[model samples]
Target chain A: MSQRPYNFAAGPAVLPEDVLRQVAAEMLDWHGSGMSVMEMSHRGKEFISIADTAQRDLRELLRVPDNFRTLFMQGGGLGENAFVPLNLSRGGKVDVVLTGSWSRKSAGEARRYADVHVAADAADSGRIPEHWDLRPDAAYVHVCTNETIDGLEFHELPVVPNDVPLVIDCSSHVLSRPIDWSRVGLAFAGAQKNLGPAGLTLVFVRDDLLGHALDICPAAFNYETVAKADSMFNTPPTFAIYVAGLVFQWLKRFEYQGLKGLAAIEQRNIDKAKLLYGAIDASSLYVNRVHPSCRSRMNVPFFLKDERLNDGFLAEAKAAGLLQLKGHKSVGGMRASIYNAMSMEGVQALVAFLKDFEARHG
Target chain B: MSQRPYNFAAGPAVLPEDVLRQVAAEMLDWHGSGMSVMEMSHRGKEFISIADTAQRDLRELLRVPDNFRTLFMQGGGLGENAFVPLNLSRGGKVDVVLTGSWSRKSAGEARRYADVHVAADAADSGRIPEHWDLRPDAAYVHVCTNETIDGLEFHELPVVPNDVPLVIDCSSHVLSRPIDWSRVGLAFAGAQKNLGPAGLTLVFVRDDLLGHALDICPAAFNYETVAKADSMFNTPPTFAIYVAGLVFQWLKRFEYQGLKGLAAIEQRNIDKAKLLYGAIDASSLYVNRVHPSCRSRMNVPFFLKDERLNDGFLAEAKAAGLLQLKGHKSVGGMRASIYNAMSMEGVQALVAFLKDFEARHG
Candidate 1:
């Protein structure tokens, strides 16, 4: 832990240190199987166990309903932006709620497959829209529950007015907190952020939402095809799934402040986010403009009030062992993605750096 | 190498021992970055360098033309079956030369996206089609250069008529031989076979074939969109790409029979095929039924003369550390998939085992 740097890049982000160590130990021989997890056949008993354990543990962690089937998939959130419409839109109209960058991209991509109408927009305020114009005949309503790029999150999910199923892109903040499964018809997240590695995408879809794929949808990406096969329609990202399974195991046994499982992690995330935001609020040289109620508990995109000090702040922070503390180009001051892997100690260290840097520059 | 088994699973198959060792050593941290490659953002400098090095090395190894762009993608061969037609078929007709199980799957998937015409069919016999009635008005001609399950391969590519672009599924034998680029327009290979792992699909497409995708094609799977972004259209399977880059580096530095680069690998593959097949041909107890000219050099599927010895053969092989020797369920006997990472030593040992097993049983 002493030799480690706190990585803060959003999506393709940090994983648990314990998971990495365990993976390293098992790289050459998994459970004495004499083959790396990457070398195992997807259909082989060994890999099937790994994949099954991951699905079971993840289902347990999320408290996903029995009606929902968790499909281990490929293609990131951006891919699902198209996959959502291809599977659910049924070549008809679809409605979207544009909260930030991700929802904007989702709407744009959906238009190619269906007539995507913006049911609600919150681009100007960087908040989840409180109002909505539901299209009763639309196939589904799409919302990016958390914008990885814009540092916005929906702490509370919206209840769709129509019977239209709600598809949520919850890539960044997926496992950080519990999901209200009743409101979600489908939830997709790229594993890199809070799960494990890139290349593996996790899609949780209700069993009823299975078979509405447009003809043009790739069979492997079709929710029904993948679900029926138990996500074995194609060879899954075996290594990523194995690692994600390890993460799930770690989460299940995790203990923090007398809490366990997802609860422990959620509590830690709250503390971590609060500490950083509290420090930011107390500072004169830093700010995060996203509405406080909707500010992401997983990703913290902050801006230097004196923007010229941005580069200096990042470099100084790096020298102090804080790393990848650069903001996305779209919002150019700074961002600190304190994902599940980020510890309370790491947040303390970051807050210390923030205070020290501001005193020097102020 | 002593600790690792001789894995012959048909991919997510065996990888270079050295690559695995290096990966293990760097699993905790990469190049003193204090973050695993899996933990880095795809757009960040470290990952970008890795992505660039891999792309460059692959281009060099394949001698991919300047006009072609190698896109690192997700979704396995099955996904690309749909992706190929969705992008290049342009909602028009496409010609397919069916050789085996894989080509059969491809033609089936393409039907959803285009007017799929079977120009040639070799279903009645396990042989590469010698002739074709190519559709001149078709968007492209599709062929599977290697059939992993059927153990049939095209030693020489079919010459498509009317200058129709040739889309080849080279999944199982991609890096084992040199591809004749002039005869190919788009080549897609799931990385599990000869590359690094599953979940990362490598698609090499000519520039001219880029933007003809129908409106319904998922933007993430769109060739032009991916090419323009240099395979970073979405997160491009960062760890798999990094490991693949290591494989490319290993291939570049590999020396056998005084040959280098793809030539070295080609020679080794040719030797490996000859060694294993020679042993099979000499024995009355074992047989390979494919036409000699079109027998796959990568996947060697052989059968015991007595069907009763199948499980016994597998048990003995496993005891002898010859792992994953069971044949594909589709063609049940025994299969030894000696891809790029399978050594001549491994093949010789397998030959020795075959002889010994037959001597005891015969």
Candidate 2:
């Protein structure tokens, strides 16, 4: 019913409308502080409260252990591609499972800091590879739990032996469902997708993983330094953090199908994914190369059987009030990113549009 | 005249009211794009246009030369302290002029990547050191043109010998006035003080300085890699960049007392600084330790002769519609950061408050 069209752009994708409205309402003044959240010093009590609440809420939402420190960092996932290795690699061997584009990039970046060995690679398969050659002596095993571009996700984390910490780049799917923190030693996500904005990065690092930073690590990006300062080691992306805090609050209050909070959102996400995947499976005109077991619930990349209809498909979708449905240039097909912000109505509308478009051209 | 109090928080400082209003108004829909600026993908046309316009407008405002690649990066000035060294240091000798706390930090950070030699030390003196011991073959000569904490500023850049590049950390004073780019190889600012929001950092690096990143440098922070990708090597802090773009537009349209754009803003800044510094000099109750010639036009750190009155002064100032008058804890006194967003009227109000406070407490 809202005039705003459904936006399906991948990362830096749609935020909840309610969160956007609240951010707008508070732009000029936040909580009677007489300063926009953007204007407040990071060290101030008001902004500190905002940062603290966001951290606490995120911990609760993810069921993150008290042993982990949640860092509100800048420099997106690409920045963390280096930060993770620099902080956790200890210039030692780093094992990476290359499930998709994000994990591949993470591996490539880690090579600069450590001797990166690919534990498993499934870039062509569009699935989380079953076998992993993770080394026990490796400092950390890296994985992209959810690949935004490849539309592949891990249903569960891979087991790493000998307590080699598992580092996951969950940029595209953090907060949509509960994180299995017990399996993750470190998790970093650029906050543009399911979180808040593009400029802020969220890093959750276990206490035991701290203080192993290579001497070359930038102090600002070092887990030990950042943990000591409570992510205020430097001036944080204050506005983005505040906006993310709002998103966290929105998620905490979310309800669906008699379920509450994270469970409710997870259920809704499952439903949305099921509906879209079902539509794709039922359609002779459409094809999804990704394996069903590993297809991302957040991003559904689909192709028309007749590749010639790609442009027409996108054009019609846009006209039908569905936007940014264009697939990434690297992968030529349509990707509908049903992030937590995407409504069921939006998904239903997309499904309806896909069927209508196929009927007209099939 | 506005209900908003005058905010003087140093970096992540106040933004222009008009820009904030426009940002708030466009939060849900941006230029009929059906997506909030925050929701749009960084690579999408709408967001690209926003990024381009911001880069272009910033170039125009600062009169940046074509030879310079302006990077819209993340990580605050603290991050840049390492990034600059990583990108430009070449694991060689880095000469740093220790002006104050910021340059000292810069020097300390640079030491992690290169052999940092203190060319000059004026940390104790609230003035730019007159003499420098320049290394002819040093990688780069570093300086903090405006020290946000110690309140010292270089009115003119120190002359580096043998064409050694002069790198400036002009975080607090960038865009407040023109830069003498002819003498500088690189200039970096965290876009919180005179720009928009806290997360976005602006770097202007000469084309020649692009390719020499140390192998240990994170590709995301590497100037050459970022420049080659047009600062899109990764997903940038899109929302922060968008807001900063709005601030750029605001600055471009700004007019003051027969001056226009940056010149007008510069004139206004000079007037504001002169008014506040004049008040401090004339009052026996107030003191600004920094020398007159080298004092910052943006962040004016002042002290009360009776140090015990500091708490009372800040409390009273906050009650009187003035906020964040407290200085940095490192050099505790009082800092009145009159960034470009600070109006002449706001400065006038602060001056009046200063007079009234002095009248009551002197």
> Could you say which candidate leads in lDDT?
2
Q: What is the TM-score of each candidate against the true structure?
A: 0.98, 0.99
lDDT of 2 by residue, B137-192 (tens): 99999999999998887888766779999999999999999999999999999999
What candidate 2 gets wrong by more than 4 Å, as runs, is none
Stretch of 10 with least lDDT, candidate 1 chain B: B124-133
Interface C-alpha root-mean-square deviation, candidates in order: 0.9, 0.7
TM-score of chain B of 1: 0.98
Scanning candidate 1 chain A in windows of ten residues, the lowest lDDT window is A1-10
- Tens digits of lDDT, candidate 2, A1-362: 68789998898899999999999999999999998998999899999999999988988898998888899998999999999999988888999888778888899899999999998888597777888887789998998999999999888887788988989899999998888888989999999999898899999999998998988899999989999998889999999999999999999999998988899999999999999999999999998999999999999999988999998888888898999999989988889999999999999999999899988998
Candidate 2 DockQ, CA atoms: 0.90
| lDDT of model number 2 | 0.91
Give the TM-score of candidate 1 (chain A): 0.98
For A268-325, candidate 1 gives per-residue lDDT tens digits of: 9999999999999999999989999899998888899888888888889889989899
RMSD value for candidate 1: 1.3
Model 1's DockQ score: 0.83
